[model samples]
Target: MRVLAAMSGGVDSAVAAARAHAAGHDVTGVHLALARNPQTFRTGARGCCTLEDSRDARRAADVIGIPFYVWDMAEQFKADVVDDFVAEYAAGRTPNPCLRCNEKIKFEAVLDRAVALGFDAVVTGHHARLGADGLLRRSVDEGKDQSYVLAVLTREQLDRAVFPLGDSTKARVREEAAERGLAVADKPDSHDICFISDGDTQGFLQRQLGDAPGDIVDGRTGERLGSHNGAYGFTVGQRKGLDLRVPAADGRPRYVLSITPVTNTVTVGPREDLEVGVVTASKVIWHGESTSVECDVQLRAHGEVYPATVTIEGDTLTARLTSPARGVAAGQAIVAYQRSADGDIVLGSATITASAPLATARA
Candidate 1:
């Protein structure tokens, strides 16, 4: 089978390509140049689209004796992922850029190109399993499972995708890379957004959207506590950097309860106020024709998956968590799963449109 392995200049992708080649499959390495100015973003021996990373991917492809090329997808990436991120935050929603990138760039744009170019499938280093039934499953390595971010992929996309690292743990992957003599085996994982060099999200937003002053209000009393440079700088559940002078009545720490971009007001309350159970999501995407299912829902990546029943109505989805989850924020992707007789299967995901406070915690 002809496969286009998406190499991100990392150990995982390198090993994935190597394994695919060793398995007697025709494999070609492709590095995505997603950033226009690579130097503006920190490479740090991690992250993709760096000049060093592109060189590393080329070297790895040479080591594995495969043809490799760099595809420039910077324009599409900025329009779809980075711009959408700014717009989501400006509209008071917390957007996941990685998920958006997978949906818009990797699976959609790159995969389309690969298929049109006569490749059978597109492979990546995503830590998610694809079953014979054409369903995406959780990775064996739970700690490194990236199935949550990939929950947005459609059935057709899953049909032509391969995740070679799904069955292996991060440690095992590094070991394999070491055995293969790949240089990035010991590189630390990238933390910040690949395009954001200084790790200053606020500065990036300010550069995109002019600074808009706002007021920070107390959630309970609706009294002004402090002023903020911009509402986009704050996120739900954030506590520090608020610079609020209001003293807590019981001396308990406060957390961000909500962000109202229309009024440019950020509300802060006791941490307990962050608990929520009901979430409404829009732009819902189910893998198949199934509309509704009782499954576990994850509000954020690496967050605990909670028991919930997801009901689809038209283009929206309502997830009622069996128990309240803290820091449930709108604009995040809520991934659903179904508990099969054997274990669990991913249902789909939707962008969180709205969230209502739990009944007991309602103001």
Candidate 2:
């Protein structure tokens, strides 16, 4: 089979491409230049699209004896991931750019192009697995599992995608790279979003959404506590940088409860106020033909998965969490997983449109 490996100039991708080559599949390496100015983004020790990263990818490809090329996806990335990120914030919703990238750019755009160029599949270093029935499964390395971000992929994309490092831990991947003499074997992981450098999400949103001054209110009492430069700069569960002088009388730390874009109000309350038991998921994409079932729902990356009963109505999914979860945010993806007769499979994912307190609490 012909494979096009998406190399991010990192150890994981390097090892993925090498394994593909050794498997006797005709392999080509492709690096995506997602940022126009790589140096502008701090990229920290772990980020893709740095000049050094591209150079490292090229060197690794040369060592692995595969044809390598860089594809400039900056414009597309800006339109899809970056622009959507700004728009979500403007609407007072927290957006995950990595999920957007996987949904729109990597799986849809890049995979489409690769198929058009006659590649059988597009391989990546993502820590997720695809079974023989084309079901997506959690990576064997639980700590490095990335199946959450990939829950948006359709059945077609999963059919033509390859994850060579799905069954291997990060440590084993590095060992494989070293055994193969890959130069990026010891490259540190990228930590932040590839496009944002200073880890200043507020600054990035402010620059894009402009200053929309608003009042921060207490969620319980509806009392105005302070003023904020922009509602877009705040997210649910955020506790710091509130810049409020008033302290809670209860002595519990306050957390952001909600952001109302219409009123430009950020609501704050005790951390317990963040707990939620019901979520309405919008723009849902189901991988399997089944429309309704019980599954494990993940609210955030590395978050504990909880049991949930899901009901799909068109593009909307209503999930009732078996137990309450804290810090559930609007605009985040709620990915569903199921344990079938075969194994664990990703059912689908939906954007969290709304969350409400359980009926018992509300009553």
Candidate 3:
């Protein structure tokens, strides 16, 4: 089988490509140049897709003895991941850029191109298992599992995907990379948003959306408590940096209950108001047959998983969590999983549109 390995200039991907080559698959390494201005992305260990990262990926591919190439995906990435991210935040919602990247850039664009180039599959270092039964499952190394972001994939996409590091832990992968003489073995893992060169998300959003001064209203009292530079700077359940003029009568720290971009209003209230029992999602991507079932619902990447009663109708998905989940913001994904003897299998995923309290949803 011919495989196109996505070398992200990281230890995990380097080891994954090496393992694919060792398995006797004709392997080619491709580094995606995702930034139009490479200088705008992070320079050191905090981000990927920089010019430094591309050079590192090429060197790793050299060590792995595979044909290498770089694909310029800056325009597509800006449209799909970066632009979508800013738009979602501007609309008063939180978006997971990693999930969007996997859905649009990696799996869709890269996989399509690989297949067109006569490659059998595209291999990556994502820590998620794809079983013989064609089910996507959690990695054995739970700490590094990435199934939440990968749940957006369809059955056909999974068919043409390969994850060589799913069965191995991060430590083991780094060890293997070092053993293989890959220089990125000790390189620090990328952190924060990859495109945010300074790691200051609020500052970055301010630069993009500009300052839209708004009022921060006390949700419980309907009284204006303070002013904010922009409503896009806050997400649901954010506590610090509110800079409110009035303190709560109860002396409790106020949390952002909601963001209304249309009115440019930030609603603040007690933390209990953030608890949500039912999540309503749209644009669902279910790979299963059942319209309704009991499963685990993960609201965010690397976040908590809750037992939920999930139902699908048309393009909508409703998840009623057995217990309340806190800080579930709109535009994040709700990924469903079914437990099995092998592992937790990804059932599907959807973008959350709203969340309500248990009583409110029941009513």
- Taking all chains together, each candidate's TM-score versus the true structure is 0.96, 0.96, 0.98
For each candidate, what is the lDDT? 0.87, 0.88, 0.93
Counting only residues 3 or more apart in sequence or on different chains, how many pairs clash (N, Cα, C under 3 Å) in candidate 1? 0
Q: What tens digits encode model 1's per-residue C-alpha lDDT throughout 1-363? A: 999999998888899999899999999999999878855345475357788888888999999999999999999999999999999999998999889999999999999999999999998988888877778888889898899999999888999999999889999999999999898888777666777767888899989888898898889999988898889998999988999888888988889999998899999999889988789998887874567777799999888999987889998998888888888788899999776653357888899988877883344
For candidate 3, write residues 147-198 as lDDT tens digits: 9999999889999999988889999998888899999999999889998977
Task: Give the range of the ten consecutive residues with the poorest summed lDDT in model 2.
Answer: 38-47
Candidate 2, 1-363: lDDT as tens digits = 999999988999999999999999999999998887755334335468778888888999999999999998989999999999999999889999999999898898999999999999999999998888788999888899999999988888888999999888999999989999998888889877777777788898888888899999898888888999999999998999898767888777899999999999999998778888888989888985777788889998888898988889888898888888888889999999997665468989999999998764345
- Candidate 1: regions farther than 4 A off: 38-43, 288-290, 340-343, 360-363
TM-score of 2: 0.96
Residue 105, model 2: Cα distance from true site in angstroms:
1.3
If both were scored by lDDT, which would come out higher, candidate 2 or candidate 3?
Answer: 3
| lDDT minimum window of 10 residues, candidate 3 | 38-47
> What lDDT score is found at residue 289 in candidate 3?
71
